[model samples]
Target: MIVSKRIAAVAAAVGLAVTGLAGTAAAAPAASTDLRLIAFNDFHGNLQPPAGSSGRVVLSNGTTVDAGGAAYLATHIAQLRGQVKNSLVLSGGDNIGASPLTSALFHDEPTIDFLNQVGVSASVIGNHELDEGYQELLRMQFGGCHPTDGCQFEKPFRGAKFPFVASNITFDNGLPAALPVTIKFVDNVPVAIIGVTLHDLPSVVTPEAIKGLKFGDEVQALNKTSRLLDLAGIRTQVVLMHQGDSTEGGGPDDCRTLPGPARDIATRASASIDVFLTGHSHQQYNCVVTDPAGNPRPLIQGASFGRLLSVVDLKINKRTGDVDRSATVAHNEVVTRTVTPDPTVQALVDKAVTLSGPIANRQVGTITADLTRTASPAGETPLGDVIADAQLAGTQGNQAVIAMTNPGGIRTDLVYATSPAGEGNGVVTYGEAFAVQPFSNIMQTITLTGAQLKNTLEQQWQASGTKFLQISSSLHYSWSQSATQGNRVSNITVNGTPVDPAGAYRVSVNNFLAAGGDGFAELKNGTNLAGGPVDLDAFTAYLTAHPNLAPPASDRVTVLP
Candidate 1:
């Protein structure tokens, strides 16, 4: 049997036998085959090494190491695959959407090419996959030029060589949106891989993007798929689910406790499923959760942005056509940059950088200090405040008095350090700004009564979680922590004047929020919908208009204890 040195060491440390199955009563399993699964998630088209904390992975010993980049990831996967004769590369999800300027500028076609070269066998559909809508996702899988932009790269857009699967997402006719399962024969044993996204997908994506889609319960879908695969004699099942949960700070392999949707699903899913690989929360964990039939299976998630890889080693019984649950070993391995990166993938990244350089490197403005999405006690962020102000300014022609933007839309911070582009310190490039707000959601203005505006603020505290809206400087309000959900927000004012519940107010927001994305349904009730410039244009214009932009104060929202 093939086993990497690291996996051997891990098995030894855990008192488990890697070879000959020492723990088992019977040792002679001549019909067994060793299979390795290498997985990563939330890549988000990071062709280049991500900068700052996003590119680092925390190790079991508490030290952080630089990790991730398409080339480096390729090298790591190759090394892992070489350790086993039979192996498959897989993805949990979020492989593309919300990408860096190098990839996003070209509509993330570069990322597809990178994945195609890496030989990803299959991947689940992440919610970000729906950012451009389902039709665009189909294009990503089927190979075609973008409908609006045509072929932007040198080669015609050749879509993903792998399947994009999601068992839970369906169209109006109740047909699956993508392939539900992909079967891989390992040593002649059929292993079924099932993919599903979070059932609460519609809440996160723009309403229009998922207008005709239906998201079913994850556990039910996984169980149903497992049953069907079982009937087809495919007993070895693996899940690539896009939904995940978080832990309070732990190493890549540490699983002191597994709490979240993933745990709940693993606990409820069919025992026929041998392993679970997850993504979307962007947290690293290597856990063993018990299935419905009380069999322990590996449940792992690598930290996002390719910083870590989830490795699962399985011993499938060729005679029984199922995995030996007790023999499975899984861990999260950091994709450190110490190794030699794959030169071919590096060339792809360099080509993309060269193609996108002129537009991406143009100086947009300057930031005196870092404008980040780090929320204060009151849930306001400096970058969020600036984005709201930018949207407000972009719609000033429509007389928008207040502007609000979702916190989730702010992808990254605007750091003041010199980037790889060698731009001067504090000099913000168009590329930097694009990474901060990559969605390109359009700016929209609507008319709402003061009472409706307050209701919109209350919508921030939803059943899912609090999603505080970054407000323009002209709008101010105080929310109480002690009060009930719908009644928590009060002390509303606009431009130093007390808001009159009966007074009509003009508010600005991105098209996503205006359409009630992120659970802010009150925004949908607003009347007189007026469209403005694309949000990215508004932000870059605001940056160019204001040369030395200072980080906005987070004193807009008052939090009462």
Candidate 2:
């Protein structure tokens, strides 16, 4: 039965007078069993502790503490699991991809090993999982050496022990891409776990990576699978969703004004869903929203990079085989490094770090100061400017006059301080540079008319959100805050020359942007496409070419009030 029908039946039974039943013997209350769920999202293969702001978690008291690292996360999970007799470890997607050098260097096999050792029951497929394409994702699941780079690790690549579930992603033939639902028998009571990613996955990932896959609506796919679980007599349902929302800077468990896709989906989702474990926006919140049947359920997200864990404890009524909504409790816990690190997991981290040390520690260049991704008021960043310059220089052989790079690709800042590897101040290592641009996207130069370039600039203000492209120093443009979306950009120039609408210009961008990823649809219309070196190579080469490199100014794009 659907949730609405079940709710209506209960409503109709309320306030009924039963004089004869009062005289009869009273029945015993239904027995309930406790089931604990330990969940995290967007680990992103940080086997070692992440550095800088990404490694910290804010508390409700407005204080922050250092957190995260695979071994530390393992210790926290073990401690949480021990609190209940029946517990399950779950991930809300992005277990790998966009990882640090140690994990990404070995094709994220070490991270999978960590997840396997820690006993993750299942996970959702995040957008970054499709970074190397679907076939590679399949390889990550079923076990195999990379088709090209065979067996980079000591042993043959073993696949993830946990299943990657996705109800919405389907093949061209209308078959599901992964397991839609996983059933876990907790103390003889069946609990169903369903997973789905954001519906707008195509806009974020490279088009070629998901060539034959179709991403369906998250609510529809979730509801459909939920109904099936209900009919199968499994009423205790949980959703591990890769799409989430944000809140004002709050503590791990604070849920002040939840606003985003996750909240919207929670309200419309089936009441049978006992709890939602969400990610994607990388924000932390613990919220309760009323479902379609007017029942409040927990919707929680732990901060990304293993910095926090979202814990949901459910009381399953053994008689009805359903979760006791009134008894459900959820909160986010910080994965602090105070606990003793799990020795086994730590060993895996040690091995990977040792094997990757040679290439990871190689000095790439020097920086005079930090080149951060923190955007200026006009949306450009010092690191983004440097990346754009690098892309242009790498493609100059193709006569590329201007270059633009997306802010999303600039993952981390290049800090001038000494690193954990003990690299001296102002020194930049190959590993650090790789972490900033881990996608290994190839550079592409294309021909676009000046008019099309303007249209591309106009696309910065998309319906989803504004994504300001970072351009090389040679290109300059100003945008208006009051002007409408398509007409906001003006004063476009290249080397101080006014842009001619009909004139053809050679522009450079990464393959992801060149294929119109991030809603930059105008980039897809370019002609005379020419491919160049990989983005990481371009970045490192540029850094090497310049000594004592200072961060470029973020004043390229003028923002008109």
Candidate 3:
């Protein structure tokens, strides 16, 4: 199958018309082409079966099953493919980055290798794709030895066997950041697929990573590209979008309360769209929402980290190359452990273990209890608090008195019995600590005025949800619920002294935030910036230095009623 290159013809015509939504379905021509699309999202390079709640699949039938791992995922994908005459494997994105020690230790080559072997045709580029920066993302797609470290795997690195489609992302030169749209031909008919991640990807990743990139509005990109594809004679439009939203529903396939950027985009984008595949929220649901033309269309999302797969069975009208919308169906299938694991993918995972497992398994320290990343209503977590303290202590030499870590930085909970290593319970390993903070971001300390710090905290409440910054124990602040946005935070103090709005404070954060990874853009304005050890190392050192660590009290930030 020939993948699509950038389509320059539509470069000048980026935005599509957003006419008022309709009230009824628009009919398409009869006679169809049966094609199956098996889609998953946010694999996050979990080569091993994800432990704890991250890997369990909850079926609508009320039965739970342990699911995921590259091997099992490969097996289930192959099984799904076997049942269809014309089938293609798909992903919403984030197949790599913020990964486990198994894959991240080697820069996610094992994941790329597994996805290629399992036949991942194409996927949208999730924000994590730019975790290492844009050049690294290109390298992941085009193939090459790492610029800093040469080949680490058995052979020279070849890029993904798939194109990463991102229609909404473009460069300043007016070209798509990635190969925008790809069509998978089924029975000589083109099934148009346009992929785009969140328009706010820069807020979720290091700002520096996306220095030269421009993110087009999601609705505009979809609307424009769908129209262009329609003009080019392709009628079956499938959107592989990484931007996602969650819904309150009866079960896995309900769309009753569908609302978010994804839902908004679905209802406002071009009416030519047939199916919407998405990720980012990492939740699972198969929904049918009224499109711009008022026709109902399937909007699906697979649970994150290889836990589930969304199988979209599309009946494309052979006569007009349009989707038979009424007959389309989608299911969020659990990647159950009952299926026989694919030995080929298993061997690849095993080989990765052999190469990196030794260092990964080394004991770092022990904790008295589980230092979890699970946040409270205030978004404070035991792990995050600990990490914030770590960054503070680690950078004390740089005159840093305060530190804040992003909640997204904490990937997994610090489990007590997660490993098979017999060092007893509550024992922390290098790999386990690595899993908690996997971004490989360097430690950075910068100067922020007391007023700017408050502004940074206020920026958190401005997002969809309040992203409460994990603060060092030395700093304390009170938040008023009834207070307005900029004034919500108050009673700021450092080392028992109320912070003067004009006073300067030395603050530390991972390199991601120092360069404004999240929406806290003020962090970028800090001067006298200095980089220290990588984040994971700083975290590991904290655990090693503080034996018998305990969870911190969730009272640092007082929330007023």
Quote model 3's TM-score: 0.91
Error of 3 at 530 (Å): 3.0
lDDT by residue (tens digit), candidate 3, 1-561: 332233223432443211111112227533556889999999999998886667677666656678888899999999999887778888899999999889998889999999899988788999988888899998898788998888898468998988888888888897766766776677656776788889888778776788889998999888878878876677888899998886553345545444588888888889999889989988778888898778998888887999988999988776778887889989888888888899999999999887887888888888888887677766688888999998888888889999999988888788776475455788898988888889888888999998898889888875565677899999888888898878888889999999988999999988878777677889988989987888888888988999888888887888787
How many angstroms is residue 355 displaced in model 1 relative to the true structure, after the best TM-score fit?
0.5
All candidates' TM-scores? 0.92, 0.92, 0.91
Question: How does model 2 fare in lDDT?
Answer: 0.87
| Ten residues in sequence with the least summed lDDT for candidate 1 | 14-23
- C-alpha lDDT of candidate 3 relative to the true structure: 0.82
The per-model lDDT (C-alpha) reads 0.87, 0.87, 0.82
lDDT of candidate 1 over 443-484, digit per residue (tens): 989999999999999999876567899999999999999999
Best candidate (score: TM-score): 2
Model 2, range 1-561, lDDT digits (tens) per residue? 123344333223321111110111226543777888999999999998887667889898988899999999999999998888778899999888999999999899999999999888889999999988999999999898988878987468889987888889999898777777776666556677788899999988988889999999999999888776666666888999999886787898889744578899988988889899999888899999999899989989998999999999999887788888899899899999999999999999999988999999999999999888878989998889999999899999999999999887877778888777898999999999998999999999999999999999999997666889989998999999999869999999998999999999999999999989999989999999999999999999999999899988777899997
User: What's the CA error at residue 484 for candidate 2, in Å?
Assistant: 1.8
CA shift of 268, model 2, Å: 1.2
Which residues of candidate 1, in runs, are more than 4 Å off? 1-29, 59-63, 256-259
